[model samples]
Target: MPQLNCIAPKPEHGSTSDPVEGGLSLTKMSSESQNKAVLAFPVQPKPLQLPLYPITLKFEEVVYKVKSEQEGFCCGGTWGTKEKTILNGITGVVCPGELLAMLGPSGSGKTTLLCALGGRLSGKLSGKITYNGQPFSGSVKRRTGFVAQDDILYPHLTVTEALFFTALLRLPNSLSRNEKLQHVEQVITELGLTRCRNSMIGGPLVRGISGGEKKRVSIAQEMLINPCLLLLDEPTSGLDSTTAQRILTTIKRLASGGRTIITTIHQPSSRLYHMFDKVVLLSEGSPIYNGPASTALDYFSSIGFSTSMIVNPADHLLDLANGISPDFKHPTEQSENMELEQKSLRENLKSSYEKNISARLKAELYNSEINNYSHTKDASIRSNRKAEQWCTSWWHQFRVLLQRGLRERRYEAFNKLRIFQVISVAVLGGLLWWHTPTSHIEDRIALLFFFSVFWGFYPLYNAVFTFPQERTMLIKERTSGMYRLSSYFLARTFGDLPLELALPTAFVFIIYWMGGLKADPVTFILSLLIVLYTVLVAQSLGLAIGAILMDIKQATTLASVTTLVFLIAGGYYVQQIPPFIVWLKYLSYSYYCYKLLLGVQYSEDDYYECSKGVLCRVADFPAVKSMGLNHLWIDVCIMALMLVGYRLVAYMALHRVQLR
Candidate 1:
């Protein structure tokens, strides 16, 4: 057998004083020297830090597997679609220090392979995949790493923050900050990703970093734990040839250095083709070829055809040999070879999986030493890692996420518009304060109406426009697993709690101190709370609206319509709502917020003359002492509920909504 050497000594250069060096000269070598020169099949690289007794990575075969997906919406109230078979029976193993490529064109069930292998796909799979001899499951995934095609990065955060945050989440706490820093630097250096290491990542037009750099960051994130088996989907998409080649080189090196890397590549260069130790080809949800890349040619040649230079071998396989062949002649709209090829590949993958890993992987088998159960058969299964319980947790994630959010506050650009308007309202309220004492009924009534209507826009503006912008980044971060949705919501609430009071508190403060809405300091404080409640109601609704309706134009339109409806229904600016539409007030955040604001803002002997003869008597809208409309507390509770429900829904829905 011919030996293949990937390791090469540095070629000697002729000693020269010139700035540009001359080309090297070769000398013929004896057979002994030739043998020393020959390389291994797949070049094995030196480990980063070898353990005293080699820390081993073992892989094993998956036998007969069947997985089904219900033919219906992931969520529904309608008749479900028929269950569709995704992975019929996939059997394959990826062992350490080997570069394994899952080659397939569109709809070839390639992604399903990774998803199933990663344990993210929920379905009944009649197969067994033992990791170091242990069966695969959700618990098995903590020690593994997976990267999807899209780069899920927070645009607001700089590159260092993003990568470091991911590192903290994946790395063992024992790894010190300096060690983590060095580890990140080493991976980035290996991938030639030093450029743009401190830029913001994504948005419609933020102009922060390149696509390739972002991809490198995404790859760097996965390398944090140095998992034994790393999975990537369409690793080369969206990259230029040079960058893609560099990426492939990195993956190849990682595999050669004793990690098992399984990735999908749509099209690969011949250089990249030579790097793969093994390849699995899939088409139309079936595998056609599963074997060595070098021998892939001979496999096709054995069938009386040769790879044409003009066509890419991957495209060739996807086109014909894989059975989605353009030359395919369907028998009554069905393919015979497709089934034959699929079954053949499944069997081959199983055989190959068993062949490559079974010998070295017995340590992973039902060994009582590492097994948990008292029973022997149950010995192969692993308990979930304690880290995963927290690693996969959205709480720890949320705190880190909230920290990032607070860090993000530097750029929040709180509107001067809100600030100016609040101050303006305060001064006017103060003028009213001086004259409001012992006022006519109409004067007092107008004051109460003004209190209710003026505060409505605050929440309206908070929930409607500004939130949609923040949602874009939050959605992306959520998809990337940056933090928990609930944590973000809670943090956002607290983070803004201080900021939320800025306008309303300021407006109420100036008026209460200067205009004198109430003599009691306690009443003044309660009024300030009412104002903050309005802001919370607005901000929460704004966030919820951002999630529910994505398009800003639509949200903007709806926000305008929403404010008007809340005003009329709350029974302040206009006549009372129809009895049938009274419940509309329940959903209207402003209605409750207004009740709270009015209770704190007035005294009943208060009557006001509006342009209209009179409004809700100033006396009627009094504080808790006489106001009866403890509706303010109801508003506070409703706002709190909106905050929680909106965030929860956003968390779940964030993954579903596409960022681009």
Candidate 2:
């Protein structure tokens, strides 16, 4: 038998202290003779570089309140409003070169406090939050990075492309392209994401990187800016223990580099818990404990809550704060009595902390820090001046977003399902109305109407799903101040034009020749142009609906009803649509497209036999005159106006929804 021994640094000080030499031993035995062997592997130490500008975040007496509605069965289910306090007098300070963990049970205001510190909270916050002795401002926000609980990224983009795009939009223009690329590459290596740098970021349907890798990519994105303060929410919520430990290890290394790192964690392993320099134990929106992580157990034990050697320290502290002792081994005690004792213990601990040593020390620290900064002049002006400058110009933002949007749309427009759908519809429609007879006025009119309706229905339905799917990513990016809403909306709307027109162009060319309406090249081209414009109008309408509702199912339902109404009012199903409701036909883009196509095909001299050659009548001119579609150019202009109008409305809707 052979044995191998390896030496590793102790986990306690390994996270924060410099590297030190350790002892090692190894033994190996041979089959025929007694032999021994030893192997040594040395780990070189690399000193972490401190941040250029260090920052310390302190919050005192922070209270957040929200107005919530309560529904009661009284008076047959009436609703009443009430005010609820979420965070009550939370005070803490996170210094540089330390990792702080906010631990609590569910609904304990951990996330709320994190959001408050990150400047992302929307509720009424009354408190004094200062960064290095100055009040929090936009400059503070620009230098701070927040990683949300969920990973919100573009699934279609590869990891390299996603990070590169973010770097372009987020890094300051003063840095050259080579510098930005170098920074991104450095971050990739730091987060251990170099292996998956070129892999696609897949979602539930697609398979790409693992869950832990995706989370790393999310962290790597924020690191590219080299922010002074990094805040993360539940960074290890759904990850395996091994992956979770790796993420925490990376965070610890990042903290050692002099960045103030704060994160909310749930039930971390004992080894993982040792990495934090400080911990804030929260219960029911209140801080139960706020001090050094290593002294937390001692503080609890001193207050009469003792733990056995078998219980994990982190778990014991959470259970005690949450009023449940899962590790209690008393078999004789009733559940009711145990619960009552737990509740009493929690209340006593909360009261003791408020009036005890930790609270007093915190108050003194806050006062001293406040006094230290009161004498400085022009502090805020210097900090905020640089923050106000945008990372890139408006034109640069538009150009980058336009390129990304076009690439995404090109991939989406030619996907298997979408291509099959477009081809299927074109093939089926062509076969259904093959080689129509011009003499049969009824059949010819029906075929032309179908052509208009098909293009309208197909594009509108697919566009309904666009905004909803991207809403989360849009909101996340907007909150980060990466780009403006108008820029994104404009890029998305216009970037889709080339592909939007391509599909319909192919459809109309095939159906126009197959259906054989008017043989003239001018007429064919005119009909194709009319159908193309109508498709754009329909797509714009769909975008508006999606932005307004922001829900796929609801938007789909509304779009369906709108499409049906337009089809009915297209002036083909029932020409005499009861004068009161006939105005709908005027609003229908399909109606205009149909009228234009017919006018292009027929002139004043064109005639049709009414009853098997019994009488040849000039139906085209009469039909055009009665419908008031004699001016084909006017219809074309109206359709174009509708396209632009719908897009404007969609833009407005998206702006309102996103800002709200």
Candidate 3:
């Protein structure tokens, strides 16, 4: 006897002791005397994982009356609606990590069974999927990984980047960057996606990787934390025989490594069929047999499904489950109306057909089991890894998310966009502000006010457009656990700061230069900050709108309306703006930006060549002595409030994934 210790096994030579399971392994530590299990393990965390709500599944006396015509829309005036019945009283058990494969034809209830397993069953399902001897409550989604038929991936992100991003969000802080990357790389290698490791998942226009690779990537993301149960919706669909075999091989490997894998496969190859540990044969929504794949023929034979000797055994097995296709021929003398009525009746009375078929199926199963004394295996559940909470702390999540947001800004070309915007604005600003030899009061006054009020316009448009693109990427990452929405909002605000500064700086310097509105450099810089600050607030508003709306179309429409209203209401009319709506002049982001723009419009804080108030009225147009209450500092304060308010609204809306 020897003592078993959970220790990180030593690697031979240059090989790393990195465990494939992402947890500790309990191995025998050989000594002189007795064998016992040690409490301590040589690992970062125990590689063992268990379901959050460990439950034993049982399907007893289940009679699911199946329906026909899964989809239909009610007509304006119709006697009744069309219908279809795919399954009747079908039932089966699916324990944790249990690989339960359902085999049937295209219209059979295999897909329905898969959906029911995931609690996605729609259209009249009357069976109870009990967990731990009780009806399932479906609070175990966090512990499950469902790989659907189509791989859900962001086309823009590469496999490694996507995996790393998922890990950074999903894995705990204890897992180092190298460890996470190692785990991700290990999955890629295992799934044979190493070649396309850096390739995009591809899309309608952008081609990057193969279907199987995409599927494997989906598995990789789901498996990042090693889920308790894996429910795959045709994990091997849309692949060639070899590719299907490889995919199934990976699935089996996962199952062999103590992961439960359940999938619905249609007409698997003979070799592929043999690889399955167990198969559930369903015909007309009723399970004929659900047990080991090895005794598939015997189970069929017991239920009077003797395979034709001439047919291939695999085809013979499938025919029992898929049903024999027989041509129907009616005599010319037969009543057409009666036949039509029969057809109509079949369509309308799908549930009756399902129940009848289901009853017959149960009878056949009971008889077969009785004659062949079938044995049920014990539901032996094991645990190695602990379940990690899906919801994370706001701050920790924020920091990680913010880092990602800032880093990913490179992808959006935000920094480049900002720099170019600022430099361009600066050049334009310099020309606008170029020395103006103005002696007359009226001309200088008009020139200064015009440059100041209009300076904030381009910043508004720039912020509005960029928000949409950034929002899209943010959504994909958020779903994949890249980070939280609040962190992104804050980072985005900060990230664009340097650029915001540059845009206003360029625009201010250029406009002042061109117009000869120079007064003081320091006052000019302060005004530039105000104008840029306005853009920041507006962009934040855009982010809020983007988050609030499910898609860009609505957001775009709303933004257009908003921009138009602000442009009109922000004291642009200066004189004719109505009294009651004067608040709009104050509330308008443009108003604040304009006010601040005017605050240092000329260039100096020196005495006015003109009287200044809200109007900055002066007999001399050029040299206005007064700095107007333009209320820019309030605008600054309000802009800050608006940024936080909009950002908060966007974050909450996005965090919930609120669809329009």
Please tell me which model should have the higher TM-score, number 1 or number 3.
1
In candidate 3, position 30 carries an lDDT of 31
TM-score of 3: 0.66
For residues 444-501, write the lDDT of model 2, one tens digit per residue: 7777888789888888987898888888888778777788777888788778787788
List the global CA lDDT of all models: 0.57, 0.76, 0.57
TM-score of candidate 1 to 2 decimals: 0.68
Q: Which candidate is the best by TM-score?
A: 2
Question: Could you tell me how far off, in angstroms, the CA of residue 77 lies in candidate 3 after the best superposition?
Answer: 11
Q: Write the per-residue lDDT of candidate 3 for residues 434-478, one digit (tens) a residue.
A: 555543345555554454344434544455555565554554344
Of the candidates shown, which would achieve the greatest lDDT relative to the real structure? 2
Q: Ranking under TM-score, best-scoring first?
A: 2, 1, 3
Instruction: For candidate 1, write residues 1-660 as lDDT tens digits.
Output: 012111211222332211111111122223343343212212213212311100122222322244344444665544533555555444344555677788876766778777666655554555665554445533345446677887766676787777777765554444444444555655666667767766677555556787777777777787765555678888888888888888888888877666667888887877777888877776555455666677866665565345545665666655553443334445675567668864564555435434543332344333422442232123223242322343435555556655766666545536576667778877977786555643453344355555556665665566555446666555444433445556666666667665566666677667666654556878777767666666666666665666677768887777778878877776555445568866887776666655665666554454555335554554453332232454455667777897577656655554445343
TM-score to native of every candidate shown: 0.68, 0.87, 0.66
Evaluate residue 370 in candidate 2 and report its C-alpha lDDT on the 0 to 100 scale: 51
Q: Which ten residues in a row have the lowest lDDT in candidate 3?
A: 1-10
Model 1 per-residue lDDT at 593:
57
Cα miss at 471, model 1 (Å)? 8.9
Q: Rank the candidates by lDDT, best first.
A: 2, 1, 3
